[model samples]
Target: MTEFIPRPDQPASTSRMPSPLVTMIVAGAVLSLCMGLRQSLGLFLQPMRAELGVSASAFGFALALQNLTWGLAQPVIGMFGDRYGPRPVLVVCGFLYSAGLLLMALGGPTIGLNIGAGVLSGVGIAGCGFGLVLGAVSRSVPPEKRVQAVGAVSAVGSLATLVIAPVCQAIIENDGWQAAALSFAAVAATIGVIALFIGGKPAPAKDHSAVASNTRQAVGEAIRHPGFVAMTLAFFACGFQLQFITVHLPTYLGICGVSTEIGAIALGVIGIANAVGSYVTGRLGTRYRPKQLLALIYLLRTVAITAFVWFPVSAFSTLAFAAIMGLLWLGVVPLVSGTVARIFGLQHFNTLFGIVFLSHQIGGFAGAWLGGVSYDLTGSYMTAWVSMALVGLGAFVLQWSMDDRDRPAPGIKDSLLGTS
Candidate 1:
């Protein structure tokens, strides 16, 4: 019998590495543009509803659909990004996102807010948001540095929120809401072009048996892992709190007789603090275990929410809540993604993590929609705030119970199922 021989062109390394700074910069710029566009949407809610004569629940439903659609599409998008490359996915996402905005601008009244603003925008976000960019970043970075890279990317979005929210408010003031929407569409289109530059390089093919096996095993193993399940559940609460606060906080404040300017400022403060928090967490992740950090962050959020509920409504309290909560906001992104990589290996990080994030978005939909529903039903936002506090505490407990060392490193265990 003749011996089998491997092809000369076969790849030696399983990983496709890029220059760290270059990847980070590209990821940051794209994420910033995407987030800036997203953050600006809150500015439109009141104006859009007023002009269209839609109920708050109708607008809420649209946003809820957007979150739901984005969550549902994440896993599929991750599969494509993992199989092909981030470039094509990013390009497509950019186009979809731009189109979604354009449709929203055009279909302001005819089809109702839910179809255009909710469904289209949600689909667009699924294509262009952190899900795709983080997948690419996860693939490009080394295992040890994956968490920091994710944190860095997440920080860019927070920074964009800080800067862009104010800029958007200014534009709405000067140009009117419609023009601001059009302007945002233009900026979103520009981001698509930038994504072309960042994600243009093709991922090199690999033939490593170990890497292939690990990728194949990752999904099933992660699904069965209690730590991963707990993390996913905890992340749902994080999403719920984040989306509820980001989407409805302005309106909630307005009900309390706060000015629009102050509301926008409160959001901007959160964004700024979030940027700082993400950076600090990312840096700390390099030296510490991310699981403990995640638990602590969630615990802080619990305390923050409780205080916000109990305290009297004042400028100081509002700003303080925004600052403290923002600091804890998105600090989990780096740690969660980093921990996934550490436990499962980078070969299938995108697919596995995408599933986890999908759960987060589901919670986001519930939080955003319920905030409006509860307010409309009771004529107050107290219920939503209380729910957020409860969820935050639950998240802290679930995160604390997760053991980081449950899963063995890739190739160290013979079978993925038997290791546990």
Candidate 2:
């Protein structure tokens, strides 16, 4: 028998690891279900507020709470996933997601909305969303193939928005908002079931004491890394911009005299285009540096927002804006996740990315809440839109200035599938 050791640059592989194809397929399905249902919640906003007699600010606050909860809960859930495995965590979150949606449907405006939409759904999203899912995917594939794997999952998952948004809109139109909420609950219940097939769990560190010490060191190293700090800060802008648009765009379109159908159509267009963008961006990651690509995304997003708002709103302009925005959308995920893996290796990837994502969710909370406050106070979302663009421009500078060079901790190896 020969002693085997994997180099720090190469991940250890073994027979017990799940097949890459199976891992990808299962991961993609989970993403599609979880993200699709989550994103479509915006469709319930108008009807729920009208019926519940809730102020726009109140409704926005609930959604804002959801983002905040998701962020606050992510690192803890991610730790669970990293330690116990994604399957059980995802299973529990799926049911939580379903229950939250049900509560939102049944619980009156404030209680249901806050507890269901804000708290439970937020925690559910923390478990099933990009940070944990992508971390799982990354560990299942080779470093050279990691970008493509992540991109593919993101692209496939993005397609869910195309169908989910429209379906929810139709349900809201025909069956009422409560029915739409219930439908979302039903869909969410499937996430856990699908998660059963996802593979790749964290390898146990050789010694429990060593693992504890390494984790502390790893967290400190990431915090001290200028690139990680820059990336985390820049991610806030990403959340602020995207969430503001997702939550407010429908209302903005309605204000501009576009039909609700047109708004739904715009969202669908975004979904379709996002698939392409996610895939192309992943391929581009192979050639261009992740930091550069991220900077470009922010710059382009700022331009699109500036142009979309500056010009008068029309169905044509709205859909066109959606196309542009969609193309630039989830493209950020692969780059961000890949950067974490490259810089820190896989040991604490989910937790590290969760920390970065907390910044994003904080921005989400601000963006969603402030959009309502701005509109309520100013009679226009123009102020929020302007703020979003400025923040994005600032993120561009931060991302561009980041140094994303690989600097894994001394004891951390590229523990992909088998190595402990």
Candidate 3:
């Protein structure tokens, strides 16, 4: 029943900051580089298995570990961004991301894959990923424009897969997976330079702002809010469905007798649709309740999954499925982040989003790891796919029934009403 109300003293927008367009562009670049490499890892799985003799489960576990690491590190990294600034966090994460890819390329099966892909890249992504970037964008824009700005950044960020996936696949086919990874690492290294233009530091919250006095209170309030709880739990399904497909879809297509090239093309199609979807979702958020839109996305995802699994596999179906999934992909981001901003304000935006994102990563861990485990155990991905669809359905129900009313921060005077 409780939700956060905006502080009256809070500025409608930040002053002396870079133009909103510049900020969103820089944020998109950071996300694109970070997410592009992370999302495209599936392309390396089969080749790695073939060359290094690693089992599917091992690779899955590594990716699961990666997601776990990213989740575990996100809150801490987000806090750092909130207190100091996002710039330093992005720079350091870029280096780590580049190093992780290099190690994955050169380290071979056991050590390289585990440390590079799992721990290092995971940590890298935690800082440079959506939470920090979206928080920065939200802080710079007006309350009314926040969701749209977040959507634009997300849409641009999704475009990375359009170019990265196909290029990586090409490199893998011609040279080797290692070569493709090395190329990814090189691209990742650019993130640090991009960070220079992001922003200097988090703007200080005004004295009369309705925000929590400290990080502890902000996190505590978020945990106690029922809507936040539902959102976090529902995010688990998002992670599960997405991670499973990203890590296993290529392999799944292969089992159905589809060529690897088709899988690559399919991911590219998802990227294209994801951009359009993210932008449209952002625009829709302005006119609709985000919770309802979120529920719809989950429902549609479930339908798409059911159809994909129930029908025959072919190039057309695969591409069409990818497009549907892509349209649904990353759309949750703007909604979830926008909801958080609406409910809590921007004082600790990244930290709060990061906590919620932890649930998503946990689901990602299960989805990625379980998909591989199921395949190894039953020799098919049917169980994992079914499980993902079930989770999405559950998410739809929970999201639909969630309470999204604004709960004012306790002890703050009623006079202190809008966002800081």
Q: Which residue segments of model 2 deviate by more than 4 Å? A: 1-8, 12-16, 204-212, 408-420
lDDT, candidate 1, 1-420, per-residue tens:
122121122221324445556667777888877766775576677777677776666666677778888888887887777677777887778777777777777776545356666676676677677776776676665555666778888887777777777777788788777777777777778777877755443354332223445455657778777899899999999889988887788787777777777777888898888888998898788777677788899889988888887878677788899999989988998888877766665556567778898989999999889988998899988898889988888888989888766455444365433453
lDDT of 2 by residue, 1-420 (tens): 122122234342424447778877888888888888877777777897688887667888888999999999998898887677777888899899899999999999988999998899999999999877887787777777777789988999889889999988999999999999988999999998888877546554322112334556767878878899999999999889888888888988989999888888888888889889999988887667888889999999999999999999999999999999999999999989888777666767778889999999999999999998998898899999999999999999999999776554444443322256
lDDT of 1: 0.75
Model 3 whole-model lDDT (C-alpha atoms): 0.88
Per-model TM-score on C-alpha atoms:
0.90, 0.93, 0.95
> What is the lDDT ranking, best to worst?
3, 2, 1
How many backbone clashes can be found in candidate 2?
Answer: 0
lDDT of candidate model 2 versus the reference: 0.84
Clashing pairs in 3: 3-406, 3-407, 4-407, 6-417, 6-418, 7-418, 7-419, 8-417, 8-418, 10-420
Query: Relative to the unseen true structure, what is the Cα RMSD of model 2?
Result: 5.2
Per-residue CA lDDT of candidate 3, range 1-420, in tens?
Answer: 223333233432456457778889999999987888888999999999999898788999999999999999999999998887888899999999899989998997887889999999999999889988998898887777778889999999989898999999999999999899899999989998998898778567543334467889888878878999999999999999999989999999999999999999988888889999999999888778888899999999999999999999998999999999999999999999988888777788889999999999999999999999999999999999899889999999999999887775564434465434
**Best candidate per lDDT, number?**
3
lDDT of each: 0.75, 0.84, 0.88
